[model samples]
Structures are given as structure tokens and as C-alpha cells.
Target: MLFRQFFDAESSTYTYLLASGRGREAVIIDPVKEQAQQYLTAIEQMDLKLVRAIDTHTHADHITALGDLRAATQCVTLMGEFTQAECVSDHVREDDIVDVDGIRLRALYTPGHTNESFSFVLQPERPEAVFTGDVLLIRGTGRTDFQGGDPHRSWDSITNKLFRLPEETIVWPAHDYKGWTASSIAEEKAHNPRLAGKTEAEYVDIMNNLNLPDPKMMDIAVPANLACGRG
Candidate 1:
């Protein structure tokens, strides 16, 4: 499998692209609207066919380039069971396999950060990795105190769903606020401050401590992303 990762330092967001060596197909995940050309250029450089674009969940920070991707490429779009999903060709479900070119991604409906948030695993018929989105991160996990979020459920998603993966399974999150990236189930199990062997009530308490404000760009970004970047 071929993979490319890019970071938008301003929003602390990371977008990724994956393709098969055959280069006959490719997909973009968690793309940022402002960084659309970066993906296009990468596709052009790799000589791959852009077949699909997806987001693990509706973004609350910067708008995504999904709209732009649709208008620019003949690619199918996806998101996880979103009531307000923008241009999603598939309301991805747990265990649903998303095939693009020669690569396949399996959706894991590990909600908690939001009802529709998901983590996807890329299994290219070999050793593979997972894109954990906001559900799980390197040393940190996504806040479950925001809109449509729940801390107790987040605890289940983390300790049960995510930790169930093999210890060697690598993780790449949607945003890295700590300049952090990459982790294994073992690493997160041992080191994740908020999730390490904590009780459900304790987890809830910790989550409640995170009094985060709403994303500054949600109103503008959500609709723009849903519309595929309407002018």
C-alpha cells in the first residue's frame, strides 16, 4: 500500500492519502479544504486514479475539501451514518469495506466523540494500520464533551473497541494537537493519560473536566464541506 500524510499546523489537523502499488485506484481521508491542491498534486505525481474521498466524521474545525474533491474528481464520497452528512455516497457502517483501487478500508463505528465518528482500518492483505480519527489518538483521545459527545460512551469505544486490536496495530489520528502521531495498542494502553485503566465514572469525570468550546469554524465549515465546497 502507498500512503501519504500531510499536516495543517494551523488547525493541527492531518489529512491522508492511500493507494495501491498498481496505482489503478486511490482514496483521500480526512482532507482539509484549504489543502485540496496538495492532494491533487500528490495524485498527479503518483499517477493514480482518484476513486473515493472520505471523512471519519463531520469536522468541527477547518472545512473539508469533500465538495471540491467531488467537483474536481469522479470519486465516491463517504462518512459514518451522519444525519447531516454532506455528499456522502455511503453512510459507512461497522464492518463495511471500502474498496478503492486495490486498497480496502474497514469501518469501525466506534462512536463517543460524536454519534457518527468512526475509525477506519486499512488492510491491504498484509500488515495494516488504522486511521483512528478523533476517537483515539497517539497519547491523547478526542474530547467527548463537545456537541453530540458523551464521555461514558467514549470510554467504551476506547478500552473495548480500539484496544481490542492487535498490539502492533499502528494508529494515525485526524488531528494531533500535541505534535504527536503514531501509536500501537500497547503504547496507548500503557501511556494514554485519560484512558489508562480508568473506571467509567473516572473517565466521565475527566471528560467533564475538558470544557472545550465549540469549533470556531463549524457554521461555515460544516455546510461548505457538505456542499462539496459550494461557491
Candidate 2:
């Protein structure tokens, strides 16, 4: 399998490119609009056909590249079924498999950061790697203060769905404020301060009182993402 992780410094967002191999079909997850050209360049260089561009949910931080990639490559644009984004070509639900050549990603409906948020588990060959979107970060979790976010649901999604995976599973989150790149389920379970030993109620209280400011681009990004980042 071929996998490359790309980072957008502006938003601290991470975009992922995955394919079975050179000349095979490929898919991108959580793409940033500003990096669309770069993504296309990489796909062309790899001799891979871009088949799908997926977003875990509507983002509030930056515009998504789904629309741009679709326009350029005619790739299907995918989002969770619960998303309000009307321009997505495919609305995947829990347990749905998103296939591209030899690759298969099983959609897991793990909402928390957003109502439509999902985590995609690469199947068959790479079941140990999960694209967690913004649900679970390296040592922290996404804020659940807006966009139908529920701290309790976030906690459930982590303890019930994500933590259920094997200890060796690799977690790839959507954004990272720190320089960290990837983390394993075991590492997070043991070291993630937010989840390590806290009860559900305690986690809820912590999330509710975070008092963090909204993303700088929320107003623009939200409406634009709903249109598939046309703005």
C-alpha cells in the first residue's frame, strides 16, 4: 500500500493520500482547499487515478478540497450521511465500505466533534490504521462546543468505539496544534490526559469549561464547506 500524509501549516490540518500502489486508484481524506494543486501534483506523480475525496464532517477551520478535487479529477466527494453538505457525491453511513481499487475504508460513525463526524478504518490490509478526523488527537480531543457537538457523545465515541480497536492501531487525527504526527490507540489510552482516567461526567465538565475561542475561519469556512468549498 502507498500512503502519504500532508500537512497544511495554516490550519494545522493533515490531509491523507492512500492507494494500494502506483497506477492504482487513490483516495484523499480531509483535504484542504489551499493544497488542492499540491494533492493533484502528487497524484499525477504517483500515476494514480483520484477516485474519491472524503471529509469526515463539515469543517469550521478551513475550506475543504473536495469540490476542487472533484472538479479536476471527477472524483466522488464523500461525507458522513448526517452531514448537511449538499454537494457531497456520496453520503456514507456506519459500516459502509469506501473502496478504491484494492483499498477499502470502513466508515465508523463516531460523532463528537460534529454531529456528522466519522472515523474511517482502513480494512483488510491495514485495519490497524484509522483516520480519526478530529475526534481523537495525539494527546487531546476535539472541542465539543458547537456544530451539534456533545461532550458525552465524544466520550462515548472514544471509550466505546475507538478504544475498542486493538492496542496497536494507529490513530491519524485531522489536526494537530503541536508538532506530533500520529499516535497509537494504546499510547493515547495510556497517556491522553483527557481520556486516561477520567469518568464520563468529569470529561463532560472539562470540555464544557474549556472556554476556547472559535476558529478564526469558522464563519467563512462553514458556509463555504456546505457548498463543498466553492467559496
TM-score (all chains, Cα) for each model: 0.93, 0.98
| Model 1 Cα lDDT, one tens digit per residue, 1-231 | 788899987678989888886456888899888898888988988888888888888777888888788778878878887537646776788888888765888888888887778888888244268898888888888888665888877888888888888878888899888777678888999988887878889888988898777788878876776665554
Best by TM-score: 2
Expressed as tens digits, the lDDT of each residue in 171-213 for candidate 2 is 9999999899999999999999999999999999999999999
* Model 1 error, position 153 (Å): 1.4
RMSD of every prediction: 1.7, 1.0
Top lDDT model:
2
